[model samples]
Structures are given as C-alpha cells and as structure tokens.
Target chain A: MELLKPELGLIIWTTIILLSLIFILTKFAWKPILKGLNDREKTIAEALNTAEKTKLEMAAMKSQHEALLNEARQERSLILKEAKDMKDAIIGEARDKAKSEGAKMIEEAKREIDNQKMAAIIEVKNAAGNLVLEVSEKILRRELNSKDEQVKYINTLIEQSKLN
Target chain B: MCEYLCATKKRVIALKVLKFKLFITIFLLSVFSVSLVSAAHGEEETNSTAPTEHNESKKEDGKFNAKKVILEHISDSHEWHFFSYPTGDGYKDVALPLPCILYNDVNGFSFFLFNKLHHGAIDGYSLNAEHHIGRSDGEGFYDLSITKNVFAMMISSILLIWLFRSAAKGYGARPNQAPTGLQNLMEVLVSFVRDEAAKPFLGKKTDKYLPYLLTVFFFIWINNMLGLLPGGANVTGNIAVTTTLALFTFILILTGSRKHYWMHILNPPGIPFGVKLILVPVEILGIITKPFALLIRLFANMTAGHLIVLSFLSMIFIFGQMSPIAGGGISIFSIAFSTFIYLLEMLVCALQAYIFTMLSSVFISEAIAGGHDHDEHAAEDLP
Candidate 1:
C-alpha cells in the first residue's frame, strides 16, 4: 500500500516538527520541570536529614532526662536514709536521758530514807537512857532512910572480911 | 481479633460478588449492542442492494476487503475520517479535509484544500487513486501539506507545551507547596524520567541531557496516547515519526561522543590485529543499528498494537458476511478482545516512551563514558 511508503515531504515535516518540539520543549518545559523536580528532591532529602538529626537529638535528650531522673531518685533515697538515721539517734538519746534522770532520783530517795532511820534510832536510845537513870535515883532515895544501921552493918561486914 | 478477621472476610466476599455482578452486566450489554449493530448493518445491506440489482453485483465485486480497510484506517490521510452514517441514497463520508500543499518543478507550488482533489484534479495536479498528490501525468511531487499525522503531531506538541507550561507555572507559583492536578501528574512523570531513566544511565551527567530525554519521552508518550483515541491519527505508528525520533537520538549520540568512543570503535583493546579487522566493522554497524533498532522497535510495536486492535474490529465485519447471528456472536468476543488490547496499549504507550528515552540516554552515556574512567584513574593517581 502507499501507506507503507515513506514520503520525503512527510519525513521532512516530521523532522522539522520533532526538532522544533525538542528545542521548544527543552527550553520552556523540560528545563523548568527538571529543575523543579531536582529542587523538590533536594528539599525532601534535606527534610529527611533534618528529621533524622532531630530524632537523634530527641533520643539523646530522652536518655539524658532518664539519667537526671535516676540521679534525683538516688539523692532522694540517700536523703531519706540520712533522715531516718538522725531520727533514730535522737530517739535513743532522749530515752537514755530519761533513764539516767530516773536512776538519779532513786539514789536520792534511798539516801534520805537511810538518814531518817539513823535519826529515829538515836532518839530511842536517848530516851531509854534517861528513863533508867530516873528509876535508879528513886530506889536509892528510898533504901538509904536508916543511916546508922546501915553504917554498922557495913563495918561488921568489913571486919569479918578482914579476919577471913 | 477473630471478630475483625470475620469482618474482613465478609467485606472481601462482598467485593467479589459486586465485581461478578459488574462483569455480567457489562457482558450482557456488549452482547446486546453487538446484536443491535449487526441487525442494523444487515438491514442496510439488504435494503440498499434490493433497490439496484446491478449495484448489488458491483458491491459483491468489491466485497469486503479487510486489509484495505485496516490499512486505510491506520494510515495517514489527507482528511480525518470519523464514523459515517447512511443518508438518503448512499453513505456519506464524515471527515475534515485538510489543506494540501504540493510543490513541483514545472508548476513550482500549489496550495488548495484536500476536498478540491476529491473532484479528480486541480490546477494540473491530481490525486492518484492511492490518494497521493502528483502531476496529471503521474509524476512524483513533493507534498508538504498538514496531513492527518502531521496535524496530530502538531496537536500533540501543542498539548505537551500547554500541559508542561502550566505545570512549570504551577511550580513557579508554589515553590515548595504541594502540587495539584496537572502539576502533580507532570511532576510524577518528570521525576520518573529524571530518577529512573536518566539518572541511572547518565549518572552525574544526567542534568546535561535530561531535557532531550524528557522531551522525547513525553512526545512519544503523548503521541501514542493520541493514536489510541477514536478518529486519531497513528502518529507514533508511522515510520516517518519514529525515524525522526531516532534521528534525534542518533544526532545526540554522535555529538556527545568523545575521542575514546571513536578509539574503541576504530581500534578496540585486548584484541589481536587480525581480530580487530572483524570487530571494527561490527562495532560501526552496531552504532548504526542502535538507532535503527530504536526506529523499527517503536514503529513496529505501535503499528502492531494498532493492527491488532483493527484486526479484532475487522473480525466482526468478516464474520457478519457469513451470517448476522455469527456476526453478532463474534462481535462480543472481538470487542472484548479489542478492549483488552486497548488497555494493554495504554501501558505500552508509556512503556515505549520510557524505553526510548532510557535507551537514548544509555547510548549517549556510552558515547561519553570513554574518557570518564580515564579521568577517574588520573585523579586517583594524582591524590
């Protein structure tokens, strides 16, 4: 068929049209389109890089925050341990002070009781001695009524004691 | 989880059922339309032939030439023919006559509408039986008219320009903003060409030849798409068009070639002198065949696709000549097959464009790749 035949005029026209298309499109279309595409690609790559960096930063910050929290927890437990030890020491000192004061009061009471007992014994002894002396005085006064008879009897007794 | 799986399974079943229903509906509709069209054709043939028995004999003489019909449909013509309908006495051709510009040595140049040639002759120039313009004595003349294919090319180019210009404007308007509509689509294609086609082969030099690659890709792709439409010219299917495209690639490859490339072709390394004699011719042939293959591959592929679809459509008429019922039954299958081929052609449209661009870039890069390694080696030796 004539259709299979490539005509010269059509070939020339096609070449002209294609060349013009290439030239025109290269200048107006593909240039800008490619530039825009490259720009977008670069932007996307930069954005992804920024996101990765930020993610790393965020992870670092998160670990740092956990470390700081751990430090605060350790400090809080240490402070709690110190506070407990101080409270125990204060309570023990108060108990020891109270026990010493009770012991001192008991010693003072025992000394006072001993002093009272000695005083009472001394008073009893004085009273007994006075009573004995008064009895003896009365007896002697009653019995020495006859002075001569008594003196004679004493002389006879003294002579008999010298002969024997 | 069980619940969710059950819900998903129900949705899948529902979707399958819906798809089956849609397929059946389309099948029935196609069959119905086929029968209706065959019936109308049969009636028209019978009615027209009954009035004039002599005309019937003449019609039988011509009969149905499928090859001619298919070729005529696929070939570039002086006019764009849409579907014609039967009028009062005969079928009228519904077509747009393009301008015919012819030049010859004697008459110098002639300009007239293509419809003028339909009357047999104009200004000593006449359209041959094959619808080619020549001298009345049947001498070959140069035709520079805007035929169907050329018009299609112009239209496709204009469309490409408009589309990309608008897309470029969109990029300018919104520097970093997201693209919408045409800009979005153009960006995807542009990026695909840049990233997939040009970058891989051209490497660092992709920017240098990216414009040509992009233009060729979009031009071929757009023309292929246009060829698929009804009443559209087979722009990409024509050898002239493909040759022009291949010529551009050939030119680029030649112009971009470095000294190393010529050296490799002339005196290849690692080959004995006796072997070099055989290898050099083959290498030179290889150079010519690269673009030749590009030309033939695209032309043949696009033309074959169109031929296959046209053949499928032709089947309906071929079977209809046997019997109306046979025609009607075949029409459904033929139309279905053609529809499938049409969808496949859509993929081929983009694929061929991509292949052409990628191969062109590969060729150019190969031509320029000679001194690149030398430079790299030199740089390594330096530092």
Candidate 2:
C-alpha cells in the first residue's frame, strides 16, 4: 500500500495537467483551427460543385452531339429519296417523249403512202393507152389495106385509142 | 485669435493636471491596499497554530508512516518548511502519500528502511516484495514523489479548463476580433496545437480531439515548466504519472480496436502458421510495448530536464563549499545551460502530451472502426 503512493502522485499530476491543458486549449487554440478546417470544407464543397456542373455540361454536349448525328442520318435519307424520285420522273418524261415521236412518224408514213398510190395509178393509165395504140397499128399493117385506106385507119386507130 | 488659442491651451493644461493627479491617487491606493492585505496575511501566517494542529490530524490519518518521499527530498535539501491556510504546519508535517492518500503506511512511524519478510534491508531501505518498488532516485527525478506529481497534474488540468472556457465564451471565428490578454495567448496556443501537433498525428480526427489534445498539451507543458521551479517539484519526473497516462492510452487502444486492427495483430494474412506463431507473441508484446514506450519517453524527457538543472545547481553547492570563485564560474555556465534546457523543456512538455493523446486517439479509432476480429481466422479457413 505504501508503495502505491508514487502511483497516486502520478495520477494527481496527470489530472492537473490534463485539466489545465483542456482549459488553455479550449480558450486559446480551438477557434482558428476550426476555422481553417471549415475553410477547407468550403473549398472542397466548391470543387465538388464545379465538378458537378462540368458533368452536367458534358451530358448536355453529349445529347447535342446525338441530336446532330440523328439530323445527319435524316438528311442522308432525304437526299437519297430525293435523288430516287428525280430519276423516276426523268425516266417517265423520256418514255412519254419517245412514244409521241413514234406516233408522229407513223402518221407521216401513212400520208406519204397515199400520195405514192395516186401517182402510180396515173402512170399505169398512160402506159396502157400507149400499148393499145401500138397493138392496133401492128394489126392493121398485117391485114395489108390500100395507102389511103391505111392513112384513114391510122387516124381512126388514134381516135379509137383516144376513146378507149 | 491669439487670445482664443491661449484660452484653449490653458484649459487643456488644467485637464492634464487633473488627470495626472487622478492617476497618481489611483495607483497609490491600489499599491497601499495590496501591501495592507499582504501584511495581514503575513501576520496570520506567523500567528497561526492551525497548521501544526492539522499536521497532527493528518499524522493520525496514517499517511507517510513509511519513508515519506517528499519529506525525504525536502529533508535532504535541509530547507525550512512552512505552511499556509489550506496546508498548515501540522498538515504540512503530516505527509500526504502519493495519489490522494489512497495508500499509506500504518502505525504512522517514519523510517529509512524496514526488513519484514526478507529480514534484511535491501540497500539500507525498506523493501516491499509484492510491489515492484523501483526508486526514482535510481530512475531519476521524474520517479521521485507521487503526491507532488499528482498535484502538478491536477493543477495543470484546472489551468486547461479555465483557459479554454474563457476563450470559448469570449471569441468565436470572427476576424478583426483581436484577442485581449489571455484570450490572445490562448488563440496562439490553439493555433500551434492545430498546426503543429494535432494536424500531423490525427489528420481528419484532429479536429475532434483538438480540445482534449490542447488541454493535455498545455497542462503537461505548464507542469513541466512548474517542475523546473527553484524548489524542484519535478512532478513530471515521476514514472507513475507517465505510467497512468500510458494506461489511459492502452485502455483507449483496446476500446477502439477495430476488426482490421485485430486481424493485423492476431491473425495476419499472407504469412505461414509457423511464422505467425513466432509473430503472435511479438505482436502481443508490441501492444504492451506501445504504452511502455510512451511512459519511458515522457518520464525520460522530464527526468532529463530535472537532472540537467539539478546537476548544474549541485555544482553551486558542491564547489561553493570548496571555492566560491570556481563555483561562481561553474554556475554562470550552468545557469545559461539550464535556461536553454528550460526553454526546450517547455516545448517537450507540450509535445509529449500531444504525442500521447494523438497516439491514444489513433489507437481508439482503429478499434472502434472494427479493424480487428477473431472470426477472421474462421473466415479465412472456410473453402
């Protein structure tokens, strides 16, 4: 028990030092350190806020990029459609022009055929009259009639030929 | 214009004269009151038989029946002892055992040594076999007397409580609020603790333990400083003080032990069974060693400071008996060295306290965070 006295002294001194320190530090030192800590907290918060805002902005930019991509796809599809429609229209117009030109050429050929038939009939009548007159003259020569009578026959033949 | 100026100057002179007279009167009154009170107290101290009577009562209480350490030191010094109201002459004579009269010798008989069981005095001093009674005279000044050490500790605690309470009430975080008197001093101390001590050890938890750490820091510092006073109280020089503090640390570490902490200490992973067996004992030893180290560090620092001071002071006495001239020369150098050590002691006092508290907090934090668990071994064994 007597040996423990030293331990008691140590305890008492420790208590005094502990109490005094608590008093001194709480009064003199805590505020500034606390303030510094708070300041650090605020700075961290600000940094977090900035990071959040940047994240949002990046998200928005990504969406905008997606919209642009969609627009490009739509534009490409529209251009392809427009090109196809233009090609079909041009083909239709060309087919119509070819049909009209073929019809006009057929009508002109029919008109030219009618004119050639009329001219051929006139030429055939002239040639038949010439042949009959030549045949009548040959038959009269073979029968051997008098000179006066031959002259009269030739005139008659011409007249008959003209009547025929 | 000249007439007006002269009139203003005359009025100013009159006011100054009145202020000077008022100041002188106030000063004289304060000085007179102080002197009167002191004189009254001095007379009372001389006339008071109360101390002797209290000392007799304390003697009856069975304190210091054994070799009284405080008395030993004082007696060795051969100085005249006196007592005040709280501790009168008899009360002073009635030696208070270390640790608030928790334990003391029976029969109220003081002696140099007693041989009860062993039937022989070890080194001509009383021997208690049950208790590992190592003398401070051997371990140095810090281990000297328990009562004085505890007194110093208590005083330091009171000082801390007072210092912080005032600061907390007076000033907050507002700038331009210049700290007046003690408040200014307190603010500086707080800053030093936060920046220098608390910041490094505890980091994020630094803020949580700021108040406690600061309390410890100033308390230890002030006591260490007080120990260096002329009479050489050497409260910090006691091993018991450091041991109690270390015990507090040990308790904190155990209570705050986390799962991870236990795993690391008891069943460390990535090591073989054979190695672990070797390591387990060592690890357990380490746990005990932490507090032991803390005790030694604080005890050694405080004791060293006292020894240096005492050694220098002893030169004055030692050489003074031989030759005054040689003694005077030695004392000059001694005083200079003592002053320098005193300044260092002031820092060490605070530093040691901070280190102890910081390490304690870290230990507790590790435990409370579930750092260590015995079940970890079973979990690891499972396929």
**DockQ of each candidate, alpha-carbon based:** 0.38, 0.16
The 0-to-1 C-alpha lDDT of every candidate, in the order given, reads 0.81, 0.57
Clashes of 1: 0
Q: Residues A1-164, candidate 2, lDDT per residue (tens digit)?
A: 33224444356546555555545555555654456445555777888999999999999999999999999999999999999999999999988998898898888888888888878887877777666768665755566577887777777776776687
CAPRI category for model 1: acceptable
TM-score of each: 0.73, 0.47
Residue A98's C-alpha lDDT in candidate 2? 88
Model 2: per-residue lDDT, tens digit, B282-341? 987888988888778877787776666556555544554344455555555656677788
Candidate 2 has an lDDT of 0.57
What lDDT does candidate 1 reach at residue A15? Answer: 89
Badly placed stretches (over 4 Å) of model 2 are A1-6, A9-164, B1-146, B172-181, B199-208, B365-383
Show model 1 residue runs off by greater than 4 Å: A1-3, A51-164, B1-60, B371-373, B376-383
Cα misplacement distance, residue A87 of candidate 1 (Å): 14
Over A1-164, each residue of candidate 1 has an lDDT whose tens digit, in order, gives 56556767678888888889878888888877767776887899999999999999999999999999999999999999999999999999998998998898888888888888888888877765664465445444555647886676555644554454
